[model samples]
Target: MTMHIDAGPRSSIALTGTEFAELDRLIFEDDDWWAMPSAEQAALRHRFITAAVAHHLEHNAAYRTFAESSGFTLADLGAPGSLVRVPQFPTRMFKRVEVRSVRAADCDVFKSSGTSGTQSMVWRDEPSLERLAGSLRPEGDIWRTLYGDVDLDDDGQMVHLGPNRREADGVWISYIMTLVEMFAATRSYVADGVLRLRDVVRDLEGALADGKFVCVAGPPVFMAELLRHMSDNGVKLSAGDRMAVITGGGWKKNESTKLDPDRLRSLAMDTFGLASAQQVRDVFNQVELNTAFIECEHHRKHVPPWVEVIVRDPRDLSPVPAGQVGLMSYLDPTARSYPCFLLAEDFGSAETDNCPCGRGGTTVHIDRRMRTSSHHGCALRLAETVRTD
Candidate 1:
């Protein structure tokens, strides 16, 4: 295997295409990933994370300096419980600066939804983008396994509640949603920033009339809007066991319109005539991270083996006990264009016990996003300590 090193102030030790391919197979293609033993999974993740850290140390000058200041070294990673010492960038930092380990010219920039009036900007090279897509492959596999009866082929249709890829260019959520198009035929109901309720009803009604398996997917807000429209118009589809509703993103955009997960599921069951609560599933992702944690049939979000999630006490950034709500942090090894080890501003807990769904490993529960006032002080402190430029 040949190795190439770039020479510059922002120099990087680039992984070869063959190396990336091997990593992708190990991380994303393994069929028995969720069933792997914890020790074996940890050892595998530690190896990849160590290499990822080394790559970022050579590529991202600011992150290297922060690591050095924190007395973190590659040797330190050899000790037990050393992974938590890995310096983490606050997720909000991406909103304030461009954090990339690869050349800007080689990256495609993506922005967050910016519901808070400020959007995070992330750069992804082709390799990182490929990994992002690969992370979703397990989701499709799990969905197929759970809903084996559903014929999710070219014959089935996916009714996307968001804009098409081109219409939502550079928007991360839309990009992730449109990826489902590759699995089956998809049609978007939103056009020019407006949700076409009539179009959505027509497509869904047509699908039910033909007994075709259909998936309605997008953010929960749009799903809620569709449900309300259907309820107000007294339109209900009896597509029991033939339709699925997949929701992602946030449940609450604001206080007045907060939609509980159970509420959303119930409304979906009534509005679309879904067979069970299992038909209404949710997916989790963020602009700063490359991996996606998808809920299984049991409604538990299973964390993939390639990444490690730590719930940290918001005050001291120390790891909290499992099943305790705190700030969520991740050590994701999928992104070659950037360091994805990040301290997110979301409140969540992790569970390591076996799930009823039979996927044995860690599962995460995303409670809610930390309020701005709650996280701003911590974010500012972290920013002052880590120099990004």
Candidate 2:
């Protein structure tokens, strides 16, 4: 079967059928691809990113104009350092314009959760959606590494703290959370804009009694609220090492209810009777990017070999030294429906050192979102065109 489904304008610069199949095999089929040598991984990333950029430049008119204005040509992507020269649209651009390499009618649009009446709409075609589904499946090597000896398919149950998939159709985080249902039996606790805390407690208690492994996942804020509710009612379950708490989406804009990572993990451990901190792992992703960065046992969010992450100075968009906090940017080759190279409105740092968990690639550390007034560089310039165009 052809892995790529392109329903938009065809381009000669795009990856050919054979090339796409090879790339897909390396990423989704080859088990040892993540453990490859750093040099080899970099070479693969360079090749894939070059093709992806070329494809987008030919198919996306807005992106092409932006690249031309920035004086970034195909020649600029020759060196490893040249990856930074690729023109990047600010993630906010998605809110202002429909940035797509595929036909609007041929893609599913996912919207980010926002209260400001402006939400980012990300387009994902069939191939792009398939890549995402493959990345999040629990049978992958990364998932096995994080969840040793815990089988979710046979003896596990998922207790999600968000709405079901149908209720969260276009909402990105909730929709992603529900995707785990495909692997394990799942029950959602939030419905009709209310968290059914009693239902969650009852199911968790039942799982504890039955001795079945449980994977509880949702936004950190919702998880925190559940933890607090259990603590207040003195309802504790002895799930010791039989349960895992997976939190994602952060405590987005919930400043008053925010709990730092350490505090959140501590609460989960104490409330759920988990034996170690390793059972509480966090996941990181955004609507624009197709890949999800999952935390290993050592608490580092491992960046896969298929993507490149850079921390850039917010003022001038130059690359920052490793471990220095700045605006987070990404070169995501998996997103073929759009130019996934983005200058995001997030503040974070990244390091390429070998992690204690035996992962050899880069590990990203996200700090917080950049203030709206702090937007700069290509993002700011792109916003100017939003008014003129």
Candidate 3:
């Protein structure tokens, strides 16, 4: 499904299905290399985000009212300066407002379990979900090619370190759960808030016994727990240069535990028997946005080509320089169902400086969730409940 862009005589811009398809194709089907033509990439993001802003202005009345009140309209988004002027709703507003571009009947509802036990509702129609899926498609197939393992197909092993899909509570968390489920031949959720070290290590042992490549993914805190257990029990396992631990959900749950990432990596290398630090990947994303910022070889979370990330001053919500730490907001053209340009509660730095990975996109360095916000959602709760010891 494509967006219905009304380009009347007075309309700022009208993009056809062909335009969307080309953008989708460019984003999904392209090869993953470091060299992205800077000029061409910028032009593509500007065109796509501008058209998306116009689409939201046309279809979402609440968004339109908010945009106009904030002194923005479809007419105001062509130039770079005006484009940044696109109004952003707070990410938490998704909880109280049902401001969707699609009709209620056409949308599928998803919920985010807040840290305080309240759930926030997110509505997405099929088309928007398709766009989200498209953004995620590229990373799903990486493991097969990681170790030159042609035999690794749907039958590959996936050891999940967090809640399973049945227990997943947010869009991004569920997205990762589904991706791991789809690509891995066999799957296991290591901990159900109760770390069963023996069972977890046994599954790892089975996956590696036959010289198979295994894709292990979950919140870093849980992975840390597993690493601690494996270290204590003297059970070091190996996949012979064919295993990877993809960590997500950050170290929020272990803030009290003081779980160090460097130590976690050290334990992972010894416990999982990964070839090198490159075999361990870190992912950055939140439920409010459609894209997942995967770490490159340099460990930079490069923003995908189709999305725009801006670092803003927390007090005034204005743009900051590349290196300065501030609130991280996103302008995502992929979501036609709701306002995708959202000011997140995350604190981070967005840099355009040359990365050793050679990828041409903003590299985001997330510091932590905003201390003032009460919306500590699913992953944090999962982390807090885990019985690490």
TM-score of 3: 0.87
Q: What is the C-alpha local distance difference test score of each model?
A: 0.77, 0.77, 0.69
Q: Candidate 2 on 208-251: residue-level lDDT in tens?
A: 78878888987777787789889888988788888888987755
Per residue, candidate 3 scores C-alpha lDDT tens digits across 21-69 of: 7677765676552256766667778888887877777777778878879
lDDT of 1 at 362: 87
Task: Give the C-alpha lDDT of model 3.
Answer: 0.69
After superposition, the stretches of candidate 3 with alpha carbons farther than 4 Å from their true spots are: 1-16, 138-151, 169-172, 190-196, 253-255, 385-389
TM-score of 1: 0.89
Clashes of each: 0, 0, 3
**Residue 361 of candidate 2: its Cα lDDT?**
80
Ranked by lDDT, top first = 2, 1, 3
Q: Against the hidden reference, what TM-scores do the models get? A: 0.89, 0.90, 0.87
Give, for candidate 1, the lowest lDDT window spanning 10 residues: 380-389
